[model samples]
Target: MEKQLRKQVTALALYQIIGGILGILLTLWVMFRGELVLTQQVLRFSLFAAALFMFSILCGRMLFRNPPRGLVLSLLHQVLQVVYFTFGEYGFQYVAGLRIGFGFDMVGSWTFKFRVALSSFQFDFGNATGQKFIGINLVALFLIFWIERLLEQGKR
Candidate 1:
């Protein structure tokens, strides 16, 4: 109902969509490539992506409950950047894990634990994965928004 709440919901939805896409892509990559073991590297990245998705949802919750569009959007951007970094750190781990015959469930849980450990330690900083996601998402979001704008303008 409220604008802030609406925006938060939208952000959460976007985060989930991105996360699902990442998971699917990782799975497909593993299936096609084929490997021996799901390494710690793969586990780590997958976990980070999962954490970032959850963090995005959490950020949305905070954003919607508060006000000021700029601030809320900024918060989203900051969190998204962090998510990207985290995904990089663990992305390879997830892929590696899959290569070793570990199911998504196990890999996903491993990621969840990794997030818990990070949160527990209160160590939140940018990593290589974050940089990767920031760049990719920037371009990807632009394309997505551009397409949406075109459709809207067409309707008008």
Candidate 2:
């Protein structure tokens, strides 16, 4: 059980680390391409990525000291992902519509049109392009959860 918990924590840590590296790289790339200015959005995303990396390390340490039950950790991860997706960089209204495809606007639209509109969020990122960082992180979380489930089943 401790090994499994450690594996889960490691998965989260990888997510954070990868996100941070990618965020930094993209920011630098944009700066080089444009006026070499660091906008507030870019700075916010960079800081958020750094914070996530730190949080991941802290969670790993805490798990080593006192491991949580698998279900509890899973629930906590899910809740955190939900909060991040809803209120993080991309903003609630946008990501929710992209993820669930059940927003108010979707109700009256044709199925195909709704799908297109929902998928558009991938490119739109609403008013803030930097919000794409959160959206990508959300996708990474989904993949991590799926991978974790697979690993758990393998153990069983």
Candidate 3:
């Protein structure tokens, strides 16, 4: 169990570090392209991603210390991720409107207006392709919980 916990923590930390570096590079590219407006958006999104990554790391640490409590924290983290992505996508489609060129049809004017009112975080939700992306994340969370349970059983 301790070994598994250590592995999970290391993996998670590495994931966050790599993601943060990539996000910084992408933001810098946008800035260099002379797209100040897009640059600002990207910067905001990057900051939000950083914050989320930090939260995940904190949760990972807590999970490492206590499996049951960690499982609950992980569940909450997944739920928060879903809400964040949903609203973030909605913001891009509705709030930013056609200005962002997300390569997809709008979700209608009324829905757009409603979403704009909800939040200001914008992200390309894969141009409204489907719920597959979110589904995969949820599934991964479930699998993590299952694996933790199995590991706990082995310890017992």
- Considering every candidate listed, which one attains the maximal TM-score? 3
Better of 1 and 3 by TM-score: 3
- Once fitted onto the true fold, the runs of candidate 2 whose alpha carbons sit more than 4 angstroms away are 1-12, 35-37, 40-42, 57-80, 83-156
lDDT of 1 at 145: 55
Per-model lDDT: 0.37, 0.41, 0.43
lDDT of 2: 0.41
User: RMSD of each candidate?
Assistant: 14.2, 8.3, 9.9
TM-score of 1: 0.32
Question: Stretches of candidate 1 above 4 Å error?
Answer: 1-36, 67-156
User: What is the lDDT for 86 in model 3?
Assistant: 38
Question: Any idea what lDDT model 1 has?
Answer: 0.37
Q: What is the lDDT of residue 62 in candidate 1?
A: 46
Error of 2 at 27 (Å): 4.0
Write the number of the candidate with greater lDDT, choosing between 1 and 2: 2
Clash number for each model: 22, 0, 0
Ranked by lDDT, the better of candidates 1 and 3 is: 3
Error of 2 at 62 (Å): 5.2
